[model samples]
Target: MASLQNAKNESHIPAELLIARVMQIHACICKLESLKPSKQVNSLFTHLVKLCTPPSSIDIKTLPQEVQEMRESLIVLCGRAEGLLELEFATFFAKTPQPLNNLNLFPYYGNYVKLANLEYRILDENGVVQPKKVAFVGSGPMPLTSIVMAKNHLKSTHFDNFDIDEAANDVARQIVSSDIEFEKRMKFVTCDIMQVKEKLGEYDCIFLAALVGMSKEDKVKIIKHIRKYMKDGGVLLVRSAKGARAFLYPVVEKHDLLDFELLSVFHPTNEVINSVVLVRKPLF
Candidate 1:
């Protein structure tokens, strides 16, 4: 019995070690709405790893001063070796979901996986209800989680969908059309998000998604363009690619966004950078 237990522990002593440990930590956190002191302090070393994977870093100067401050604090809180590993773990758990017996990732990627926003939960503190004009800015095989979330969470008027890759748009169109329930609510635009550039600032919500590692200039242009379209006080949500590089491409100068506040930082189980970073446009 003892030998078998040791063997099980030893099996996880490789590249997947940190991922396994983070899963343990996540399980622990799930039991408590807020982790106790022991959990928080001990979380630093739980996902110990043997080697580094992603061998790159970016100039921190581009981050917002506050994000920079938080980065420094996180680094100090977690020592060099462990900090990197924890980030690996964070990247892992934040992106990928725990796998099932029959399912592993589609491979060919690393760092973090992404969750479909369909699994996302929205909250309301005030009683006022408003339906929104929602925009989904990608076309891919990823299921319609964001649209589902939009339909349920936001009082949605219509779903405006676009994809740069026409084939990808076709895939989205098929999946949405087959859903039967969501068919009438969605309109797929097989073109650049900029096609309806004039409507940028008019949408009640916007969803950008999982295309990581694209050209830096393109990311900047997209963010700048979206800033003009996303409605004031509307939600700006992103589902970045899984296991992508450290920052969202080129870190398009801060405040280039019309956002006022961040709603949540939702990191899911690892796969792709399937994270949901929800922001609200400023009322200015």
Candidate 2:
């Protein structure tokens, strides 16, 4: 649909506070990275970096080389963080579903449920049902989006999770396998979307994760690639950022999705992210 206003404007958080947060996040990243060469550490570092980004008004480029380099490094780190975070989350929950306090998972799950509800409402309005194939690009380790959708929506029989990290895939599979009932509803694959050449048009629904792309350019490319393989009239649910969350990465604007018919846009009343639902345009 059309672009909507954000629930709140977070730019008023104060420049001094933003600077302080950057320092805190930077120190945390340094400490975590120093501990080991684990993927979890790398993922945390990337998150810390994204959380550290200041508002656009403050130009980080004017800083010293070292500082500028640090900002630059965060860009690269966030791209890797997706797979790394999946690996970390998968390892943590592989034994049990309980999340550690340090993971700060409650907000994450809450946000997922909020967005999933939006997906559910749209599907219901459109008369979408179960036994329909659904694929989640960038499923991460937990696949919480799919899990939430399954629990809340109860539609979409087979949910396929695709990610580049094999470890992440293993974690998702383990989590899904833990529940025999859910086992049949979910499948995890460890290939990048670009690598899957055939049978890509089978899905009735697709989800592109919030952190799937490294940059705006990358996101556009990924969307364009997936658009080619989508079954006509199939729905695409994209989780995008807004307001404060835009600091993590630039949010997808209306122009970014002109190739598809924008069905609707849903902004979370309590959360930071938004959802954009679209359908493929007819071949001319």
Candidate 3:
């Protein structure tokens, strides 16, 4: 995968071939009413992931107008596929007696485990070793990152999870309800991130989920809003993407985080799909 900061020179892959592959994957994804565990569905997703793992020769910005439109449409479709997958498993786990134990049932649960560990390491390196209170914006129906962090890493940290969908929040609450410790530590708020201005300052660290803002403009708006209300010196971790992964998630540029002091950005070369951008609110 290409790191946004240090992308390699363009590869020799033909743009037409790439577009064809993208279209094939797009068609398969579109046919799905909901994501489930099937050999065919698994194979399709595997191919999709492999297709996106390589650095593209064609710069997304320099793509032909029609190709760019296709790219945008594909990205939106992929995001919806991901959401449906999460909701499918979240609804399933919500009815189970022990949701945490059944997390493995979700095909991508291990990915979230890796992501949580990665983010935790970034926080530790940036002096946020033990954030007392953390806020996760756009925490979807699964809320796997918070659940993983609370269970494995930040045992004592209190998490305030915000989601625009009340149904998602309800499913998230039920998913964690059986765990006594999680029940005490995790609180889900059903509202958009933009509406939680006054309470933002209370968190030691804030996480912006990858799908929080599908467009660059909307992402910048949310980031700026967080910068305005976040406490001085607070840590902000925004999930971004690079290289071919940018086709699946929005890429956050350094300039998008205008007011915050840019700390570090890590783009994983492995199966970890989202890039992590860590920044801090300037004390001054």
Candidate 4:
């Protein structure tokens, strides 16, 4: 384990070593949360916070692709740990039962509500009042953003959801299946964004969740990959944390966006993040 001082001097550490360490920390947190004792959970949560907090100068380009993908899981796990500790919840899945009809994302309601507002603002500003096809990448268990869009923006048949977590994808599929119209309209897949090879040229808009972890290489490759498949004038909406939330959902810089044309940046009204809208510049 690197000392806090050693963390500050990250140049000495190998990228693969760091990646392995981070991935192990992520897996450990996932397992530890399932144990009964609250004290044990708190102790693991504290240790994880230290392990996952990267040094400001840490070069993301050096990390492995798998580690980059697991970053968001760590962030969300850390956030859930904090919330769980505060609420005195015994285990990770200690939340109150949800009614089948209401897909309320309790703790995460604020995040999705803010995203819904930002989506509308972007659509209005870009004169895309009604996007024909929309994709939600890294959609979690509830897929609240897709739910909101189905109610307000996209037709049920025009939505596609993707996530790397099979369990999450299953839950999201189940939720979408609960509504006949949504079941007919939505397609949910369990896959990494970087590995998708199917034709996606029909989707005019794509939403990247705040926790969609991507290293510099991962970002570039996926952007290029999606660029090839997305409609010529497609818009990619990337949600990232700003200010102090960078400890978890790190800020996504302009350089990381690579060759895409940046359209606008929108700050959330009730959250600690900002959203970037990027457009596919027309081909010559």
Candidate 5:
């Protein structure tokens, strides 16, 4: 309760205390069969989000060995919670008569809207104007980013969404199937990004979702694979994390991006869960 109070107060939460609190919350999140809107769960998530916000400086390497041991598990737990929330909504929307119209009912729908706007602005600034074809790697069940971007920002661009899970792709397709415009613009492919060899070069821009690779090694491998197949001068937008958010998501460092020309890295000091890393494939 004290740790919860500390999170509410927005004080400098001790790393060990924060870790313990997260473990408790994770336990609660795991017990749920479906992520229905519960006041207790919502309050827990609210406190966790507050704790993860700005003003907390936590370096993963500097933590004690025991605490470090819990980091990966915590990340996995958080990712599972996120996936459950998405699947819950995706399943609901898939069953609905018109899912697209009810998209705003999603709790984190506003986050995707803001994120798409930010990514669109970044792409526009970096000379990716009116890209004809774009690809989104690891697009989950909801695929809200692709929908939001295609519907709002890049009205003319076609979005090819790649996800490893066939069920997720099915859910995504069902969610967007009712809209005629989305049916024309959004295409869901059920395959890993590594499997798409030749078609990768067709895209002018690619977005890598945050939960694509949960480990640094896996992330580097995916990045290298994309670099090998992606067209020259293609734009890559990676969703990353900074500050306390690293506790919930994997962090991508500059060194990990070896071949790409680093363009911009924007870390929001607000509630946005992901930081954006914009880079480009060199023409040479």
Candidate 6:
């Protein structure tokens, strides 16, 4: 009900909780209902960009119905909060409205595909009905997409999408054979993520994907936690091979711990570094 936490089983954002947050934000913005639609929408997006930029999870691409209701509520609440919200809109979009395009995926977001391949390869090496051993972080459409692709590509690696977004899970369930197939592959849970770093330890391999946008300090904290979970001789299939300049790279080097190697970097469409680094925790 309050920032739910579960790193395994399933990760999800309840509709009820989402509605509550919207209500609260709207109450604060109820004085500017008289503003122009353009100004009002702009104001709302701005506030969203600031207050909810890195959504609790990055798995959700489209806002859900309840969330849409909340957005409407904020527009109706239009006043001082709306004014400030519009300012936020001006700052973020500056001019563009929300795009009508599909999959606002950023360029160079290739790690998901590689991670899927790693999962598939592991399944090929193992068996189906794995006993809740593997854990994936940040499962959104991309990760699930990877799983579907892997399954079709080789009938391997049955993994469930572990994300905190219900809407995302809904999307994953849409593919024809995806329900049963995804059910076998995915075990959804509402995880705190930090908790995952604690409870799950020493996997055969930890497939990870780090991003450039994360703050250095937060990134370090996450890596330190991940280091604790890996089993000795365990491998880390990481996205972003050039991350030696990134925080985790430095931390791994500083501690003189992982045996890191770059597997390959492929371009889906001329994007940079489909960089995939396979890292193994040292035996010592």
Task: Please list the Cα RMSD from the true structure of every candidate, rounded to 1 decimal place.
Answer: 13.8, 7.2, 4.7, 8.0, 2.4, 16.5
Of the pair 1 and 2, which is ahead by TM-score? 2
lDDT of 3 at 240: 89
Q: Quick one: best TM-score, which candidate?
A: 5
The lDDT for every candidate, in the order shown, is 0.45, 0.63, 0.84, 0.61, 0.84, 0.40
Which stretches in model 2 have alpha-carbon errors above 4 Å? 1-11, 14-86, 97-107, 126-131, 272-274
lDDT of 4 at 58: 47
- In model 5, what lDDT does residue 188 have? 94
Which 10 residues in a row give candidate 3 its minimum summed lDDT?
Answer: 1-10
Per-residue lDDT, model 3, residue 278, is 99
**In candidate 1, what are the lDDT values of residues 1-284, reduced to their tens digit?**
11222432442244234334434433443454432235443443233111111322334456456554443333223233332332333233323433111112323112221233222443242111344566777634332444445444553556777766565455455545544556676777767676667767667667675452144456656765776667777776665322212222223233434344666555443333244566676678
For model 4, the superposed segments whose C-alpha errors exceed 4 Å read 1-100, 155-157, 272-274
User: Of 2 and 5, which scores higher on lDDT?
Assistant: 5
Kindly report which residue stretches of model 6 are placed more than 4 angstroms away from their true locations once superposed: 1-133, 152-160, 164-167, 173-177, 241-269
Better of 3 and 4 by TM-score: 3
Q: Write the per-residue lDDT of candidate 6 for residues 1-284, one digit (tens) a residue.
A: 12212211122445344445445545544544544445555454334322332223322215566644554344334323333332333233222333112122322224334545554554444332233345555454334334544345434444433455554444434432334544565555555455675444535555454431133355456555666666655555444322111111111222322333323232222222233445555556
Q: What is the per-residue lDDT of model 3 for residues 152-248, given as tens digits with 9 covering 90 to 100?
A: 9998999999999999899999999989988999999999888888899999999999988887778899999999999999999999888777767
Measured with C-alpha atoms, the lDDT of residue 52 in candidate 4 is: 38
Error of 1 at 233 (Å): 1.3
39: Cα error in model 2, Å? 17
TM-score of each: 0.50, 0.72, 0.90, 0.65, 0.91, 0.43
Q: Which stretch of 10 consecutive residues in model 2 shows the poorest summed lDDT?
A: 1-10
Give the runs in model 1 whose Cα sits over 4 Å from its true position: 1-114, 117-119, 122-131, 141-143, 147-157, 240-260, 268-272
Assess the local accuracy of residue 108 in candidate 6 as a C-alpha lDDT between 0 and 100: 21
Ranking by TM-score: 5, 3, 2, 4, 1, 6
Model 1 backbone overlap count: 25
